[model samples]
Target: MLNTQIKYIDYISKVNDEIEKTNLPDKVIEKFQLKETIEAIEKVELLVPVIGAFSAGKSSLLNSFLGDKKLPEKITPETALATELRYSEDEHIEAVGANSDITTFSIDDIEEIKDRAKDFKYLRMYLKNENIKNIEPLILVDMPGFESPLDLHNQAIMEYINRGVHYIVLSSVEDGTITKSMRRQLENIQAYERGFSFFLSKTNLKPKEEVEEIKQQVQDQLEDYFDITNEIGLVDDNGGESLQRVLSKIDPEQLIKTIFLEDLKDNYFSIKEAINTSISASGKTKEENNRAIQQLQKALDETLQKKNNLIEETKSRYSDIRINAIVEAVSMDLSNSIEEIVSVGMSGDSNALSETILEIAKSSLIVNVKDSMNDISGEIVNDFSTGLSNLNSVMADFTISENWIAGIAETTKKMITGASNKLNTIVSERKKVQNNNEDIDKTYKAVTSVLAITTEVVNPIVEVAIVFLPEILSFVFAAIQENKQKEKIRTTILTTTIPSLKRNLRAKLPEMFNAQVNELISQIGEQFEEAIENKQASIENAQKEREEENRNMEQIIQTYKKADKAITTLANNTLYKE
Candidate 1:
């Protein structure tokens, strides 16, 4: 981890040193994002959220790590949950309100926090704990339990998951196998393109041999479901050593790299392109420069003219078959669980039935939408990247005018050494974003960007569940007669619940996802516009440098040579793969 940090910091420091000698424009310097990358390293935190059932020893695992200090447990309040633990010298606590306001409280005032827990979104504890400090940028969160009410906890957990946190899932060893609730949580995680480290708590309560059998069962279940990034560990009454081992498994170095590598590469490519374009444009005839500018203006203008078309097309493409299948699949999944729900109702667990069914509904829909919507949304954006590449192809043809025959453009003169050029590079203003790396990068951006906003697609279902579930449950229980046949009771519950789930699921599912789809389309358009604008600015800068008699041209080229050499030496030093 120290080495990774040092390497990036050194790389950025060297780039900054070169920037000082280079006479690049402020925009290009900002595009390099050297300072921003450093700041991001400081700001980036690995959120390790402990997610599990109501009495799943989540707090115990967290408390074990805290050692002397502990989270609010046993007496944790309803409609208010999830505690974020971070290290601070101040050693105080903060109450983040439901609407995100902050109120300060002393560590001893945890009782006060519990009294008004309903007023808080979650409690943020700043402690001087050694374990917390040892992890540095990793922040541990006791996320709301999987069985928490749909009105509150589901949305909260969903939001946190979208933030790209690693989850530590804890369940009681006594539970034998993965519970239905845990299964739903696991599915939700999988749908978000994430996996978790499973921990079995209260292991001390059971025999060692029994623990082994149960652990195997849980491990087998996870492997059956996923490709298994399982770091299955055991925690007991005392927060077991497995807590630290599981916590230690999250490599901050990898997280940091995953966060910034692609962007850093992007900046390098873009700045290099700008440098190339500047050098090439220095020799173009005023006639050739004007033609390029005209072509750029026409492209930009056409983008504006076609902005609505792009949005409609993306929304249309995503909505047609894929989203419908996902929504319908949610209904089918919920319907399949009808017997289980009927059994809950039949057993007279009326209070839990509604919440249980709600969990199934919300989880099924959340999983289905995330599984389909995120990928589809990503594919949609990658399509834009490809199309943008094609646009560059058109410009490629235009840039190949008489100026290229004389080899003024660097593309004509130089044999590029890298695997690819950027979509909106200054030099490769006429190149398409058709490379594998660029496609993957764009797809990553599309998925992550959509993820941040995709929670909107699931929130309506939760809102509907709040009002719909209790009412449907009431109808179901009322219709379920004491002397009724078992099949009749099942039919009663099914008729009552499935329609409600399907209707509500269908109602807002499409609308919400489509809304995000359109928003992503708009965002993709903005990125495209921004990229094209950069190209235009590069040309204008070239025209300015040309107008100025190219006095600094050689100096700029020297800086590029140094930068190019440095980049080549460290090209493969990054932690992320293509």
Candidate 2:
């Protein structure tokens, strides 16, 4: 995967080189900002945000998961800026200003840090915590309680929305409902490309039955009011098994995996679009190269006919075979990868699964498409280079924009890396689930759900990325002009013949490629969804079997009186005082 990333970076460098050679108008280059987008591929990180209203036990919940009172808990509606906690060798903090300057601070300066956060964009806390050791290379942001300071909430949303950041929406069970403001936050968070999980905080304060009722109510509210269908997990205020259960639901590794692939796919298509725009917008003259243009048209007509015939023949003979091959290969790959990870997770050893899935992500269709760009470029160049020496200069110039091939390659590499990081977070968080069969059951459900969601989110985008630039033939003809061809036979080719060729290739190639990719994605998605269903069914069957056994044991053991307490434990009482 890392090798692919390096190759991808190299590909981007090459594309930049091509862009420079083309000397595209400054406005076009600036409009696309292809260079900046290419550079962003490496810097992308999955933002896992924790957000909720004040006095909702948000800080307590995060502190419990980290096994330390890291975040400052407040009783009143004291405004706080967004704060990101990441792993570090030495504990420290940095305030990142809106203008991009950083101010470092010692860990002891709590008041100073708070003051800085008020004026700063966000504060980055570097902590060495054993609880989150497995989730290294993670950025867990704790934003100001939603609705605390309106501007801070908006700023947080605007700043991190596009950076592949998913959210953990925290709502207190004390209210037993979703508020209007909270619904608005949910709407905003769901608008991004990333997925989100709902966290019902202070679940321990209510009876188990009451807690379950609250969850149902919230889920129904989500469906009725917002039409959302996200999983909501219980976060015990006392930080026990319930807390672990909630943590298990928001798998960081899975988030990273999904977001990376998503971004990579987006980046690849954007580059293709930019290259196409640049080519279409290039300057052309009709009268100056009329003779050469006529010869070019005749040649292009002959060449396009041959190409079209070849595509049709291939489509007739090999289309089904290619589709089956792709579906079979990807299904086997995804099945093996998912099964292996599920097996490990069910065994209470999810840590080893990240590397395995990362390997699988490396071989996804988008990555494969990116990897194939160079060969595809070479093939197009070879196919067009045949039977004409007069058009070689033009063909060569057309091939220069093939630099976008590298850009595509680079995007896929980043996709895998991002997914790998998120997978790491999932595994790391899973470690908090103790080595018990009960926790293992929870692990199974969590891993299965994450895998299913990942498949659903990633499959369509891969299809799009693979088919984004179906035929490079359009850009290939834009550069074939000779200043010295006074009156060549192909001069008309530039105006009439080449445009027709472009239309034929555009019309045919995309249809063929799209059909193949759509079939591949559809087959894979079905197989994956079926696999998830089967696994879920098996787990349910096993649980039923266990319940039957437990019932028999309960009858044998005889009934005992259960203690009923008059006073309930308050969530705030157990929170770390700090």
Tens-place lDDT per residue, model 1, 421-499, is: 1222221221223342444322212212434455667776677668767776666777554653567667876676677
| lDDT leader | 1
RMSD of 1: 7.9
Candidate 2 accuracy as lDDT: 0.47
Off by over 4 Å in 1: 76-80, 229-231, 312-317, 320-323, 375-448, 480-486, 550-556, 570-578
Kindly list the per-residue Cα lDDT of model 2 for residues 261-374, writing each as its tens digit: 444345334434434332322222323233334544655465555445545554444344443444344445445444343443333322223223322422443333322322
Estimate the TM-score of every prediction.
Answer: 0.84, 0.43
**Candidate maximizing TM-score:** 1
